[model samples]
Target: MTTQKKVSRQVTLELEAGNAAMVDIGKMLGPTGVNTRQLKLDYDEATAPQRGEIVPVVVTVFEDRSYALRYKTPPTAHLIRKAVGLEKGAGRPGSQTVAKLSREQLREIAERKLPDLNTDDVEAAMRQIAGTARSMGVLVAD
Candidate 1:
């Protein structure tokens, strides 16, 4: 049986899906002695389907310089803005309402975010996401 390599370090980065800049990758992984070029190609290929979203990636570098990557879904704010068709959140969250989102839409977003969320209960997840929406001046409709 093959044994897993010892992890040398771990780095987390948020990159544009499928279009991460080589310069950014080199800047982050170069100091670690990891192969930045290979990492960029692999990341771009794996995230191709999520081209327009931002994807959070965790890179685990092994002692031998090999690495593994784990990808997380886009940020809640991004997802919320996409659902509401907005380019950005309100300038003043509580005072200015920018858009509205239905409960169904909330549930869908919660489900999508379940894997990265702290709670297992969908209801709790919905509540957490709703809080984020509220902070962004997005009203959650009944």
Candidate 2:
């Protein structure tokens, strides 16, 4: 019996959901000559729900040019921006306030992010969310 060992490398990219172009894939993959058609199709399907949002994608490329894709949840900053109806986070995180979110909203955002968070408890997750809010100049208040 013979076993074949595969060599692979991982590349992380922030791709626009359902809108990945050949040029973008080419730039990320370099001259490796991987299959961009299949990659585009799969990426589009996986990121369908997150259209218009920049989401992180991890691509594992093998020696034979075959690759696999993994999608990561959007960052806390991104989620906070969405919740506060802001186009982007504050230019100066400190000494500048861009938006405000209530405690209830903070909990809600934390709950939505629980699955992706490192903590198991909701309160712990809420605290983490609050920290991100603070960095983004989103004051968590009443």
Candidate 3:
């Protein structure tokens, strides 16, 4: 029977989906003794569908120099910006209203982000997303 390899550490990286480069992966995981080339290939294939979004990956490095990757949903800010057709959020969010999002849009985003959110209740997740939108100066419409 094969024994399980002990986990050495975990590294978190936020990369443009389907666009992971071997150089970048090597830069981050080289010191940890993981095979960056294999990681990049797997990541690129797995995230191919989300080409334009940012996907967060958690790499669990094992003692034998092997690793496992866990993919997370895109950031809430990215989703919000995409929905509003903005390249970026307001520089002065507190004083400037950059855009507005309807409640329905808020719910849709909440649903998308539910798996990563702290609460299981969709209503609570919507509130959290609304708060994030407000921080970016995106008003939530009734």
RMSD of 1: 1.3
Q: Every model's Cα RMSD, please? A: 1.3, 2.3, 1.3
Kindly list the per-residue Cα lDDT of model 1 for residues 41-135, writing each as its tens digit.
89999999999999999999999999999999889999999999999998999999999999999999999999999989999999999999999
Off by over 4 Å in 1: none
Better of 1 and 3 by TM-score: 3
Ranked by TM-score from best down, the candidates are 3, 1, 2
RMSD of 3: 1.3
Global lDDT of model 2: 0.85
lDDT of 3 by residue, 1-142 (tens): 9988899989889888999867778888999988788899899999999999999999999999899999998999999999989898889998999999999999999999999999999999999999999999999999
Best by lDDT: 1
Question: In candidate 2, where is summed lDDT lowest over 10 consecutive residues?
Answer: 3-12
lDDT of each: 0.94, 0.85, 0.92
What does candidate 2 score on TM? 0.84
Q: After superposition, how far is residue 34 of candidate 1 from its true place, in Å?
A: 1.0
Q: Give the TM-score of candidate 3.
A: 0.94
Where does candidate 2 clash, by residue pair? none
Candidate 1 overall lDDT versus native: 0.94
True-structure RMSD for candidate 2: 2.3
